[model samples]
Target: MEWLVLLLIGLVGGTIGSLVGLGGGIIVVPALLFFSTYTVILNDISPQVAVGTSLLVIVFTGLSSTLMYMKHKKVDYKSGFLFFIGSGPGGVVGAYVNSYLKVDSFSVYFGIFVILTSIILMFREKLKRKEKVNHFPFQRVYTDGEGTTYTYGFRPITAVIISFIVGFSSGLFGIGGGSLMVPAMILLFGFPAHVAVATSMFMIFLSSILSSVTHMTMGNIDWELALFLVPGAWVGGQMGAWLNTRLKSKTVIHLFRMVLIIVGFRLIYEGLAQ
Candidate 1:
């Protein structure tokens, strides 16, 4: 019964995550903590174990979502590849640091971070882009499977720095980093919402793989919990990616904001209550 519940949670998390490029960790982590604490487990789960297992599940969710998005030609391979290069080293550093963290103390800090990010995302639509959107040295034109074209400008150095920060935080917190990357791509780099989502998922796939491997080596993961969630995550990932093709860019952003606000508040509450 517990396994079934976890599978259902994964399905919901993956579906929502893939639709907006959040990679399901935001949803999965809280669900894992809740279940392990009051209902699902015979013993309480440590926050580190819950976080570690969440990262493992993201491996499958990211892979499934990336492949599905790639099929639509929505993923910007060059950008994701570049970000992966920076994130790799950062991920290793984050994992090493996380090993020394205390779960209880880290949870409050993590909660505060999530809430702050949520506040930013809430007003993201209202934030004005500078007139110099085209000023970045590196720019690209990409066409999706539907033949819709998009052009965006970015500074390679800035992108690398941001990717490193995102990767480091993601590895430390057992997140996929798409939460940070998606907003940065759209708001800072002027990427189309769909392209940002697809590209972010691809980058997350690479980062999470590295992070998960590190967590495994540190013995942080709960294999049984991850096993229970993977199958559902796979199916939901495909389902959400398919839905993304049909959704409007504004709708996607709105959904993304809504999820962030809800999850952010929930995390904040959990952090304080615990």
Candidate 2:
């Protein structure tokens, strides 16, 4: 019964994650904290296990959504590859250090990430409110209407720098990595909402893979439960892509920011609870 509930939750999480380029952690983590709390074998320890297992799960989730994004011509390979370069190594280093962390330490770390994420996100929203869209970079990206034209002559440099920061954070936190990538791409670099979401998913696919490998090498991955999760993640990814087809990007972005804020407070509460 609990597995059934998690599968349903994974579906919704994947759908929401696909739409927003959030890498699905937004859905999985919260469910572990609140919803999955009702289930057995996942009571108090669910949050920690869920964070790990979800990262392992989203490798497939990101891959599926990434392929869909590619089909739609939403991928920006130049930037995506650059971001992967840094995130991959960072994930390895992060996993190696995971063993040193205690639950209290994780709570504190999560609190810091939540606050930093919220601050950056709040700043981005402020910029959006004050700035003109016409001045945005990458204005005529993706399609040229008559042709499948794409351009990234220099965007990868800035994106790579940002990716380093995002990847480092991901490795440190065990997050899917999009929690930082999506906002960094959009507000910092002015990527189109669709492109940012799509590319972030792709980037996370790499980061998460490396993180999983590192964790697995260190014997941190739980293969039995991870296998149980694959189906749920697959269903979720497809549903998320479908949802993205219908939702507005701004609405999705705003909602994601809200989740960041709530998660930030939740982490802070947990950290202080001890």
Candidate 3:
């Protein structure tokens, strides 16, 4: 039963994470903490363990989604690699910080972060788009499947600084840096939504590698639970990538925002009550 729950969590996390470019750790980390605390099924799950395990699962989820996005030509490889330059080292730093958080404090902080992310999603569409800067050193022109061309660019140093913050959040919370990165790409960097999602997953894959290694050295991972979670996350990533091609995501986004709100409040309440 515990294994079954873990599988479902991975599947749901992967699908939503891939579809939205949030790196599925948002779902996995919370679910692990909730189940371990509120039920008899999963026992002895510390926040550190949950975060480490989630990051490991994100590695597979990001890989599976990235491969699918690559075939679709949605991923911007150059930008993804560039973002990784900052995110990799930032992730290591974040992982080290995670060791200092206690369960109640972790829950409260994570809840607040999740709620803020959902709010960002809510207001993102209404936000004024950034004007294109033609003189930036990292200019990109992307053509999607429908032949719609998008021109977006950012200074390499600016991008690196932003990505470092995103990676730090991912390492500290294990929620996949994409939650922050996707919005930054769209609002700050002028990336098309699909392109942002794809590239964010690519960055998540790379950053997760560094963060997970840090967690591994800290002995925070649960190998048995990760074994169950990873396969489901991998399959779900493929499913999500396929769905992103077919679905209109507005409705999905609306539903997901509600879920995030509920989960965020619950986590906050749990932390305060404890």
Candidate 4:
């Protein structure tokens, strides 16, 4: 029964998360933290362990989603690589820092982060404006496997700074960092929605690998439950990626925003109650 619940958590979390490049960590972490049976079943359950397990699960979820995106050729390797360079080290730092914080403190901060992210996502469309980028360092033109072309420019230095911050937050909070990356890519760096989603997945793949490894060393992961969760995440990730190819960019953003809002409220409630 416990295993069954874990599987379901992974499935739902992976589907929604992969669709928006969130990597399902938001879903998994909260579920583990609040589920009625979570602490009951796992005697050693802590917020840090919950977060660590989520990160480990994201490793497979990100891989599955990335492969699916690769098939569609939506990945922007150059930007993805730049994001990874900064995020990798940041993830290590965040994971280590987690050892110093209490669960309640982390919960409050996580709630705040979720709420802020939701607000930004909600207002992003209304804030969209035409801006000219004349001197960004990284410029790219690429065609996806579906023959859709995207042209965009971004500053490498800016991307690295943001990616590092995103990585740090992801490692500290046990998220995939996609919640931050997707919005930054679109709103801050002027990336197309689909490209942002795809590239975010690639970045998540890189940073989560490092974060999960750090968590492993800290004894903060639950391997027994991860065994149940990973399968569901893998299957759901592929499904979500496939659905992404068929949806319009606006629809994807709307869905992503809705998820964030709902999750954010729940997180806030949990933090206050604690």
Candidate 5:
């Protein structure tokens, strides 16, 4: 039953993460911490272990989703690599920082982060992008499945700096960092929605690799639990990428925002009570 629950958690996390480029870690990490702390099913799940395991799982989730998105030609490979420049090192730094946090403090900070992410998603659509002339060094033109062309660009240094922050959050919290990156790509850098999501997943893949490696060296991963989670996450990643083409994600996004808020408050309460 515990194994089954873990699988389900992976499935749900991967699907939503892939669908929105949030990287399923947001779901997986909290679920692990909650179950381990509140129930007998999971035992002794420290924040470091939960985060490390989540990052490991996100590697597969990102890989699976990126592969699916690739078929649609939405991923911006060049930009993804550029972003990785900062994110990779930042992930290492974040992983080191994670070691210093206690359970209660981790819970409170993570809860706050989750709430902030929810707020970002909630208002992202309403936030208007300022019109500006494109003079950035890196320019990209993308054509979606519907044959609509979108042009976007960003300064290479700026993108790397942003991705570094995103990567740091991922390392610290075991999230995919797409929650932050996707929004920045769309609102700040003028990336098309699909392109932003796909590219963000690519960056997640790369950053997760570096973060997971750091976690591994710290001996924070639970290989037994990770075994159960990876398969579901893989399947869910594919499912999400497929659904992205067929479904209107507005409803899903709304539902996800509510879930984040609920989870965020619960975590905060738990930390305070502890």
Candidate 6:
């Protein structure tokens, strides 16, 4: 029964997360809550443990999903790497704080942020001005390790600020922060959807790695549970990438945020209800 529970949870959560770049937090957190509802082991930890452990699984989730984006050439190495500066350190600090911090203090903001981003993502076309960048936004020429040279329209300051905030959230909430990061890259920085998604996966990778490490430092991660979660996330992430390709961008974007708002409220309600 335990094995079955874990498997189903992984499949359901993994599929949704991979599909939407949700990082499986919506599923994992609630699933952990459910698991604890009837079980002794996982139930014993404070809410902090649950959030920390859920974050730990993302290490594998990012690894598995990022490959699909790379294969498609949707990744923008320059911006992705630049964004790393903020996510990496922020993740470490955030993870450390979560071990002893009260996430509830921040939950309201998290919900609000998610809700707002969802709204913007959904109504993206309404917000866009006619001025589109035909040229890259930065003056520097970047060459990827594979020797693909390109000019980007992205501003580093923007990436740094967003990455820092996103990273802080990643650590604090144990959410991947992609739900916030991906859309921002698209709507604010003018990254293509695929590029945004691909880049966000890698960014999630860095953030999750630091977060997991910090959680483990507190002896918080359940490796046994991660074993159940990671493999399934990989499969789901691929199918998600495929779906992202087929979906109507504007419609999906709008729907994505509405989903976030609903889910965010649902999560907050569930947490408070408990």
lDDT of each: 0.78, 0.67, 0.92, 0.82, 0.92, 0.68
Question: How does each model score on TM-score?
Answer: 0.89, 0.80, 0.97, 0.90, 0.97, 0.80
lDDT for model 4 comes to 0.82
For 151-254, candidate 4 gives per-residue lDDT tens digits of 67788888899999989988988888887888788776767777788889888988999999999999999899899999999998898898889975467667
Q: For residues 39-125, could you state the per-residue lDDT of candidate 6 as single tens digits?
A: 864544455666677787776667667777777666667677888898888888877777665545444545665576566555555
Residue-wise lDDT of candidate 3 within 63-148, one digit each (tens)? 99999999998999999999999999999999999999999999999999999989988986565546666877788998877788
Candidate 6 regions off by >4 Å?
Answer: 38-42, 103-121, 124-131, 134-152, 249-263, 270-274
- Runs off by more than 4 Å, candidate 4: 36-44, 125-131, 144-148, 249-266
Error of 1 at 237 (Å): 1.1
Clash pairs detected, candidate 3: none
Off by over 4 Å in 5: 127-133
Q: What are the clashing pairs of model 5?
A: none
RMSD of each: 2.5, 4.1, 1.1, 2.4, 1.1, 4.4
What count of clashes does model 3 give? 0
Q: Give residue 88's error in model 2 in angstroms.
A: 1.0
> Model 3, 152: alpha-carbon shift in Å?
1.0
Candidate 2, residues 167-218, lDDT tens digits: the string is 6666556567776777767666656656777888899888888777666665
Q: What is the per-residue lDDT of model 1 for residues 1-274, given as tens digits with 9 covering 90 to 100? A: 7878889978977887788787888778777766766674524777677667777888888899999987887888999999888777777778778888665566676676666666655665564433356778878787666677667878998999999988887788777777788888887887877778888888888988888888889888888888889999998889889998996445756665666567666666766776
Clash pairs, model 4 backbone: none
Candidate 3 whole-model C-alpha lDDT, 0 to 1: 0.92
Model 1 clash pairs are none
